[model samples]
Target: MSETENKITFEEFRKVELKVGRILSAENLPGYKKILRIIVDLGGEEREIMSGLAKHYQPEEIVNKNVIVCTNLEPRKFGDQVSDGMILAASNDNGRPILLTVVEDTNPGSQIT
Candidate 1:
């Protein structure tokens, strides 16, 4: 198949675990210019996620915000933090990252779509 036809199947897409997680806390990574280390509460469990949103968002601006995340990604270590998931965001033409937020308040770990 051509690359265009090689896209993920519906089953594969369903396997991606997208869930809403509330930002319990956020902080700048020491010595890093564009990474924010955030702790997210996924209802029953809390995990740390590293996002390159520092250039667009501040810690105080993002805290308590309900955002979407891929909960099944493999953990990655950056600096001294091990990120357990990825925060979802949209980018503008200018390449600024705009975080995806829920329309209404939902319990953390609520499935997305």
Candidate 2:
């Protein structure tokens, strides 16, 4: 795709509320080997987010880790779980995925501008 087509307008980008979320809990989704259901604390409010990280991470590997989350995405139903947000990650061609994290410790729900 061309850069023009791939680029998003500032107004359109602003619609996504990207924030930091601290993972409170994480577990493998039943019968789903590639997915993990994680509960994240976004400061005061908590949200359940389902992420496909089991291929690269274990449940114990992500708990307490602060990650960037897209808080404005429309809820998605995967299997029996309803995911309310999306965790951001960077995946390389080797298929290794790394969760995006802050350089310094920051408060949960801190807006990423």
Best by lDDT: 2
| lDDT per model vs. reference | 0.93, 0.95
Worst 10 residues of 2 by lDDT: 1-10
Task: Report the C-alpha lDDT of model 1 over 4-100, residue by residue, as the tens digit.
Answer: 8889999999999999999999999887899999999999999999999999998999999999999999999898789899999999999999899
**By TM-score, who's the top model here?**
2
Model 2 agreement with the true structure over 2-112: per-residue lDDT tens digits: 888899988998898999999999999998889999999999999999999988998999999999999999999988889999999998899789999999999999999
Off by over 4 Å in 1: 1-6
Clashes of each: 0, 0
True-vs-predicted CA distance for residue 70, candidate 2, Å? 0.2
Candidate 2 whole-model C-alpha lDDT, 0 to 1: 0.95
Once model 2 is optimally superposed onto the true structure by TM-score, how far is the C-alpha of residue 46 displaced, in angstroms? 0.7
As for model 2, its CA RMSD to the true structure in angstroms is: 0.9
